[model samples]
Target: MPLALRDAFIDLEQYERLCAAAGEGERLEYLDGEVVRMMVGGSTAHHALTRRLDGLIADRLAPGGPCAVFRETMRLEAGTARFYPDVFVACGAGVAPDAETRGVPGATVILEVLSPSTERYDRGRKWLRYQSLPDLRHFALVAQDQCRIEAFHRQAAGWHYELLVGPDAVLRLEAVGVELRLGEVYAVLPALAAGADDRPAQAAFTPAQVASIAAMRGLPVSGEIEALLAELEPDACAAAVAALVAGDGVGGWAAILPERLHARLNARPDDASERG
Candidate 1:
């Protein structure tokens, strides 16, 4: 059964009290004055990647350094909402301690491993809220099923985006003076076979099938496709692509697919050339 939120808006102190009474291992978050339940379990790939990234950050920072790395259990207070980033770093002075709550006032860097249920909130609402943190220098969104990461960093002009794809690529966190290779980041995960689908069998189409459809439609298969494929079952995946190819439009599929996937497919060039 899914966890249910209490029927009223909650303040930070009340939120902390609810967390304590709920006991350990019950993951929850406060968003827009509502205490929402986070997805309880994560895929093995998500867990592994998070742990590896945490270790990588910790090793780079070392003990008694200016910064420290913390995992998802740590709470972060940003504006009126609270988030438990997959992994984060706090630099200079340590986090302000609260006996009832755990998390830093502001994080130097924040990372989140995308999941099917939370991808929208992570990319949309959470992203907007995170940018407001005064100490945040970088924010990264990692894909669990593919070797890809999108990092956003603050710059003099404004925030800038950098995309890293493929196992050979490296993610450099210049703010914290550490670099991590995609290969290292994805280490220990089951190898995804060439032209094979990484999503569960229930999906409408596999990654390979999506690529084939894209090729037929004269569209290029992109990282966004891979990310979408990670969330869908074989049949639904195939149906979504087919709808786009047939020019019947994505309206019917939008009801069934994630908003992000719908937006990506909609943005593709209509005159795209077939991949050779």
Candidate 2:
């Protein structure tokens, strides 16, 4: 989600005051003289990717770790900008003891899970401002809609860019001496995985993807599904999976129903999405 700007302006000092008085779980950010309130509880894909990346980076580091991975809850200070990145890593004594509402001066690496609304700003001004942090060695933009990672590494000469795509690509974080596989990064997304191919039938529901969907829908994993898949016509099964991967889970289903029936159902929908 994108930040909602308030009708007010503040410097770094006033930003700290607001943060101190802000309620628990409330997150506020400052950039270019604007006070931005972040929208909490982003899409399922965003949270899933963040959780996976956090663990992947943290696990690879030593226990107690030379550098610690911080989630969105941690505040990061970059030159004149004060914002919370989705995932970041800071090394050594940058974190001050007894500092509660404060933040580390900078970070070794910063990452943001790109949302449709904020992708441009994140890759532009935010990325430019982050370059001021002397200790910042890497910055990465994680895509929530697909299996891709765009990274910028600081070199002695300047910055180098790298793009990693597909489930097989690996992201090398030399600053922290860790690597993240795209397969592991997108584990919860049923449509993508390590070594995934364009075989529509085979891609429909791999064992791991089936398990993930089952867990999400709270369905039991009996042998029945395997039997049912075998009994269904191959073309029909393929078409059904294609609908699911098409993005709108409901619209895909509606397209198959008789026009009259679909219209009636849409008028009185009772899906979980409607409840919210």
Candidate 3:
């Protein structure tokens, strides 16, 4: 039977009880003080890949492990809101307050399986919200239809991005002390003839991209100044340029970086060029 769609209101307490009662039966999420039913049936490809990835990580953290691997039902806190990540790895033992409660400042890593309907929100609004969490160490955006994945690692200052080109690139999860090859992640899915070299070009940032980068940096809304700011942080600007050049600008690089750091980075670029 298909799940029913109803605008059901539940606070954090009530949501806990409801989720516990449902068990593994139907899918629900807390949105605007209401429990909204999520699409229980995902695409075959999505489920296949999700299961494979989940199994691989869980198998790794079986007994006396450093972390706990959880699937769809585990809720992670982001500001006042709660998000149900597709897969997550929590470094600590007490992710949930109890068996019935979702985690609070729990997950070290969060994964989002991207689809056409969710690609924008996952990258934009939701991504912004996730940034507010201090415990979150990394965010992995998995492309459901394509042979691509983007991982963002939170550094002391800000965040950095890594792109896994093909099914051969080894992805390292330093935050969770694990490493996964692209093959393991994409296993059981259809074969991809494309290798790293045959994959699409990398993303790069250009002068035009400065505004977006500056906005991410929390700079004022101006293109020229933003471009100048980008020039100021040549490394960051170079990263953006590289992403634009590679054609994957929409990847996580821009969002992962904090706005204030860009201001500090501006000094380095200016100091270097002044010496030359």
Candidate 4:
């Protein structure tokens, strides 16, 4: 079934029921009355990065301290919206364990690892919704494929944005008294090959082309594919498609492609060589 049509117009109650009934390995989030499934699984790099960040943040907080760090399974409630940020921290006397609850009511910092499938929503709609949380002070978006992190800090002057690039760059979460080096965040992942230039070149294919490729591969193309691909160079784009055709999946491509597509394509047989 098309993802969009899977669970349309569900309210908070229905969404909660669906989440409760969901099997262990299933992850679902309610967004604008729709239940969106997170990517089936994260890449090794993605998992490693999330773990590293979680550990780093946890280490900074005193044991049984006022703040607690949580992985993706903990949901954050903002109005009627429920979301599972990749990593977040909740602090202060307001924090408490509620057995009947999946919502963290006092989250002060939130982080998300960027994937091709959900980058658009994470950067736009979700970012906006997360800002509505009364206690949210920091939101950081980490790139799984590159040594880049975009940190948004909520200040009395309003929201501030900072782009930290390169492995040596340091990201300071002043709200939580934690600092993360880009290298540490990207540790264990393969180094990103330098493009001819720092800026992403013009995309070699249009949205139609990407959609056609997905259709040919029996994959579903999300709305973010075009923008994600736009960030890659022509060579990287061609290489990614070639990798998919060669049966290596997105693994052989640069990390810029959607992780979900990579996982799906990796499961399929490589027929490009056979057809050739």
lDDT of each: 0.69, 0.67, 0.61, 0.67
* 10 residues in a row with least lDDT, candidate 1: 192-201
lDDT of 3 by residue, 1-276 (tens): 113245565577876677668746466666457565555547887777778778888776647866887777667766566667788887765554444465555678888877656554566546666767777888888876556677887776467777675777876778777787876677666564244335553332244444454354343443334444444443455455334323323333333234654444444433332211
What's model 4's TM-score? 0.67
156-199 per-residue lDDT for model 2 (tens digits)? 75566666778888888899898888888888776766435454
Candidate 1 local lDDT, residue 149: 80
Q: Which stretches of candidate 2 lie over 4 Å from their true place?
A: 96-98, 194-276
Q: What is the lDDT of candidate 4?
A: 0.67
* Global local distance difference test of model 3: 0.61
Alpha carbon deviation, residue 164, candidate 4 (Å): 0.3
Model 1 C-alpha lDDT per residue in residues 60-82, reported as the tens digit of each score: 87566688888898888787788
